[model samples]
Target: MSLMITDECINCDVCEPECPNGAISQGEEIYVIDPNLCTECVGHFDEPQCQQVCPVDCIPLDPGHEESREQLYAKYERIMAVEE
Candidate 1:
């Protein structure tokens, strides 16, 4: 599943740089995770980097955007292809 930033986010800016997929971005009040870019670190790390670095534990699983491992990998590939 893609991760999402909760309202509990402190906006400390700690998680932005930790995201390998560049999914996290600064929103009006908190950091937001772009689901289209979020791979839950499937192709990049063993765990979600943003979640790992979040200080307030504000990053939560996006139940609305639940995806399987195969879907996550495909998302990663699509994003990486654009970069290349």
Candidate 2:
């Protein structure tokens, strides 16, 4: 599943760089996660780097964009392919 930044986010900007997928960005109010790009750090790291760096624990799984691990890996592969 993709991760989401909640209203509880402090806008610390720590999470943005930690996201290997480049899914986190500054939103109008709080940091936002693009579900289409988020991969929960699959194919890059064993765990979500954003969540690890988030001090407030505001990042959570986006239930609305639920996806399996295989799907997340596929997304990662697609992203890597595009970059290449």
Candidate 3:
């Protein structure tokens, strides 16, 4: 599943750089995760780097954008292919 930054986010600016997928960005209010680009670090890391660095724990799996591990991995591959 893709991760989301909730309203509880402190805007500490830590999660943005930690996202290997470049999914996290500064929203009008809080940080937002682009579901299209989010892979939860499936092909890059074992765990979501943004979640690890987030102090407020505001980042959570987005139920609305639920995806299986295989799907995430596929998305990661697609992203990598585009970059290459």
| lDDT per residue as tens, model 1, 1-84 | 899999999989899999888889999988899999999999899999888888789898999999999999999999999999
TM-score of 2: 0.98
Please rank every candidate by lDDT, starting with the best. 3, 2, 1
Tell me the tens digit of each residue's lDDT in model 2 across 1-84.
999999999999899998887898899999999999999999999999998999999888999999999999999999999999
> Per-prediction RMSD in angstroms?
0.7, 0.5, 0.5
**Regions of model 2 farther than 4 Å from truth:** none
Over the stretch 4-44, how does candidate 3's per-residue lDDT look in tens digits?
99999999999999888899999999999999999999999
Against the hidden reference, what TM-scores do the models get? 0.96, 0.98, 0.98
- Model 1 CA lDDT for position 8: 98
Higher TM-score: candidate 1 or 2?
2
Q: What is the lDDT of candidate 1?
A: 0.92
